[model samples]
Target: MFRSMLVAVDGSDIGQKALEQGLAVARAMEIPVHVVHVIQTAAYPALALSDLPPPDIAQQALLDALYREAEEILAGAERTAAAAGVPVTTHKQLGHPGAEIIALARKVGAGLIVVGSHGKGKLGRLFLGSTSSYVVDHATSTVMVVRCEPGAS
Candidate 1:
């Protein structure tokens, strides 16, 4: 039985499905749910690439932007969970997606961690190694994954 649940959301339809799935479980258990979104710096695309080394300021700025994006994703998840009558908290993390998710799970003392099979990015999860798959294989806590077919909206 899960007393606290951690839902890792990334704004993809699959991620939305995972959020809904986690929300249902948390509501059934009448326990708190924590929604997390991570914008991994490595996952982010470089901007204005040039022969000249990019300024450290530019790299930091890009990271800042990614964190903002992460916040928006978590905010949307928070609103969705609240509307569904589930008490939820949101967090934004930066790092490898899998590592950040597992770290957040531990931080929240969540007994369960949930994630989607694929993200909304151009690179398919098979290539990037689905965050859900990684978490399920590596996380210390229990994990639940909701998979959506490729090309699903």
Candidate 2:
């Protein structure tokens, strides 16, 4: 029933699962899939307080590395979608992962959003927060959270 599907991949093993699942759904429904990899700036706090070099230089370096990783993640998603014979579009965003994903889903009119749960225990969630949880709570569209398989790391 979805017009389009948005698959959020963060390069984690569980994220890979979400991508595969999303592609399968897209293929079944004959709908295009949109893949988005958000570079969560807040995830890296060390760079914000680096005393080794100018803050701008350190920040830029971190941004560059994040973007490279994002590119690789998106590329892999695209290849997977292609092999599944599903049409796909990819987005690289810089911001909070959950917010960027929701915004892109709305912008692309994606009726379904597929994301992966880190399954970081309660303690981990308390300290690091969970992107999948945020998306499920804040997204207006349907969200499918792929749980991390036990021992899948």
Best by TM-score: 2
lDDT of each: 0.82, 0.89
Task: Estimate, for each residue in 45-67, the C-alpha lDDT of model 2 and write its tens digit.
Answer: 75434353655776688788888
Off by over 4 Å in 1: 44-55, 119-126, 150-153
lDDT of 1 by residue, 1-153 (tens): 777999988888888999999999888899899888877656555532444365488687876777777878888888889899998888887668899999888988999998887544546655666677679888999988787887676
Could you tally the backbone clashes for each prediction? 0, 0
Name the best candidate (by lDDT): 2
RMSD of 1: 4.6
Model 1 TM-score relative to the real fold: 0.82
Task: Quote the lDDT for 69 in model 1.
Answer: 78
lDDT of 2 at 89: 93
User: Which residue pairs in model 2 clash with each other?
Assistant: none
